[model samples]
Target chain A: MMLEILTYPDPRLKEPSTTVETFDEELRNFLSNLEETMRAGPGGVGIAAPQVGRFQRIAIVDVSSHKKVTKHHGRLVLINPEITDWDGFEIAREGCMSVPDYTGNVIRATHIKLTAQNENAEIKYFEMEGYEARAVQHELDHLDGLLFLDRLVSRRHDLFQRKTHQKKK
Target chain B: MKNWFMLALVGQDRVGIVAQITDALYRGGCNLGEASMLRLGTSFTMMMMVNTQLDENTLISVIQPTAEKLGLHLHLDQIEGELHPHPEPDVKIVVHGADRAGIVAQVTGELANAGLNILDLETGVGGSDKKPFYFMQIEGNATQGMEALQLALEKLKETLQGNIDINLSPLETFDL
Candidate 1:
């Protein structure tokens, strides 16, 4: 049962999801279908449970399926995932399946560790870097109702760039 | 449907500009949409997309006084359609080196040659006099990946002799 990927303006994408409390067949079926839906899309590496209209903390990311993911190594099905640590920063442009026709530079931690549950309700741990790290962050945003646009790094010049707009004396 | 208006304001940087403008618009019942405000050197610019039940003439009349009081130039144009995210084919182009002539033209010329369209280009020359620097950020699209245009910039930096550095990344869009 492959689920429909929710696009922007879909209220479901904005509503926050709850944690997955049980590791049962229904959850397994949803996870599997979510994985299928993600794999079937072009340039898709991950999908959150809420994306398919399931308001639960479940997401599947198989970076291995993306042409560029082969350069990295990791595939995950996460339930109630939490980031325990983060380090550094990388700003890169990102597009989302949920929000089409836009891509913006998002700041992501260069390194991160995540604690989550697999389909069996078993706890899984991940320490990853590079594209995989960004994929995880992007999927995690959905669980909390955040799109990359929410993390846009525009106007960074407010911090250090010379103020060319200063009034002349 | 409500009418859309684009308001552009540029003037010397100062406090209270946003407060005054927004307060007036809020009082007039204007719905503000996507907007960007930036300070460049001694100048400040703000561009906003707004929706309201007012006509362009009414908008200018309402905003013009604020512009006059602040000594800012204003341009307001009525537009149609709702504002949404835009994904143009572009790259994040960063060029930095010592200040000099023709840096912009040389780089933009290269981009033009590669068939790219620039959406936003910001150039600045600032730093200590002993080590003045030129910095630029060009948001543009060249029908190819960063690698494809590598030679265009590498050659320019080689010829310009500013010890120029260039970084390019594809402006990727995820269309579902």
Candidate 2:
């Protein structure tokens, strides 16, 4: 089941999500739907619960399908995710399903060590770098009621409007 | 119905320019839209879209006094058709080299020939007066795709004979 993604200016997208306390069947069910929604989106490699109007610290990431990314953890279901440590800095352009009209250059940590829970409520730790790290950071931001627009390095120099026409892969 | 106009102003760098202009527009019952305000060297420039019930003459009368007091050059033109033109850029091109003439013209000429539409561009000169460096970043849509645009840039770079460095990359976005 694919969940409906809320676009920008939807006040709920700005509302911070609470941590997931119970790891039960309901939580697992929602995670499955979130993964379906992410896969259904055009070029979407990750998604957070808040994007579907659910106020929970849950996100799904799977960058294995991305040709440029060689290092990825396949499909990761992160519940109550937290970045334990981060290092390095780089700027990359980012676009979100919520903010469909524009893309912006954002500075993010190049590497990050994070802790999250799997669908079975097992705590897991992972180290991510490069594009994978960037994707995780982007989804994590949604849990905190943040958007790429908030992290733009420079509004004038870094912000760009997305082209209306889609390019063929 | 809304009357849309493009307003342009340029003047020496000074404080309260925006405050004064906006205040006058507010008093004249004008609503502000998209705006770009920046400083170039010692001068400040502003380009804005304004919507109001006033005609050109009346609009000028409303902003004229503020413009005169600030010693700024002001121009107002009624907008026709689309208020916002040009799509977002799909590619980013960066050029760096020693200060020289024809860099912008030649580079942009190639892009134009390739049918790419330049959406935003900024150029600056740095380093000492003895050995100045020119840097430019351009965001545009490459209708012919990144490969074709990259080839065109490569050809342009060769034409310059290693005098300048040009880097072309796709402006990609991930849905996260």
Candidate 3:
């Protein structure tokens, strides 16, 4: 089942998701749907429960198929994810499905060590860097009711409109 | 019916400029749309889109008193068409080198020749006054795509010699 992705200006997207305290079969089912929704989107590398209007802290990330990403965790299902530590910083441009018309330059940690729970409620620790780390950070932000617009490094210099290009004759 | 106007205000840096201007607009029942306000050196500048029922002359009259009190140079133009037009910037370009002449002209000229539309550009001088460093960041879009745009910038970098550094990268975006 593919979930409906909430776009910008939807009040639900701004509301923080509650922690997932109970890991059950239903939770597993929703995670599967979240993955489906992610795969359905155009070039979507990740998805979060909150994006589907589910007020639960759940997110999925998979950058294995991305051409530029040489290394990744394949697919990551993070529940109640927390970044235990992060190091370094880099500014890169990003776009979100929620905010489809614009992209912005954002500064994010280059590397991170995080702890999260799997579908079976087993705690897992992981280290991520480069594009994967950036992807995880972007998904985690959705759990907190934050968007890439909120993380823009410079409001004046960083924000840009995503315009469609017309092929020249 | 609401009329739209582009408003520009510049004045020496001081407190209450924004407050006074905004207060006047509020009293005049004018609503602000998109606005950018910043301090450059010892002066403050503001550009804003204003929506109001007042005509051009009346709107000018409303803001003139506040502008005069604040010692601001004011310009207001009645504008037509969409207030928000989408700007497409497909690539991000950063250039830095020792301060010299023709950097902006040469870079922009190359970009224009490559059929790239510059959406946003900002340049600044840093380092010591004795050894000033110039840097510019440009966001642009090209009809030919990122690969061709990168090639053009590379050629321009070579032409500028070793004194200037140019970095061009596509705007990387991931949907989530």
Task: Point to the candidate with the largest DockQ.
Answer: 2
Query: Which residues of candidate 2, in runs, are more than 4 Å off?
Result: A155-169, B80-86
Per-residue lDDT tens digits for candidate 2, residues A1-169, read 9899999999999999998889888887888888888998876698999999999999999999988889888989999999999999877778888887667778899999999999888999999998899999999999999999988887454435456797889
Chain A TM per prediction: 0.87, 0.90, 0.89
TM-scores for candidates 1 onward, in order: 0.82, 0.88, 0.84
Docking class of 2: acceptable
Residue pairs of candidate 3 with colliding backbone atoms = none
lDDT by residue (tens digit), candidate 3, B1-176: 35889999999989989999999998999999878888887999999989999988999999999999889999989887355565656778889999999999998888777777887877888889899999898887876777777778888978987889988877655555
- In DockQ, how does model 1 score against the reference complex? 0.38
**CA lDDT, every prediction?**
0.80, 0.88, 0.86
Candidate 1 residues lying further than 4 Å off, grouped into runs, are A2-18, A40-42, A71-75, A144-146, A158-169, B1-5, B26-30, B51-55, B78-82, B144-148, B171-176
Best by lDDT: 2
Residue-level lDDT of model 1, residues B1-176, one tens digit each, is 45888899999988999999988788788989888888888999999988889888888888888888998999988887476746365577888988878778888888678666787888888799898999998887677656658777777767876578878776655322
Instruction: Please give the distance, in angstroms, between residue B4's alpha carbon in candidate 1 and its true position after superposition.
Output: 4.4
lDDT of candidate 3 over A1-169, digit per residue (tens): 9888899989888899999999988888899888988988876788888899998999999989898888788989999999999999888878887877677778889999999998988999999998999999999999999999888887454434457698999
Order of candidates by DockQ, top first?
2, 3, 1
True C-alpha contacts between chains kept, each model in order: 0.44, 0.69, 0.67
Q: DockQ for the candidate 2 complex? A: 0.42
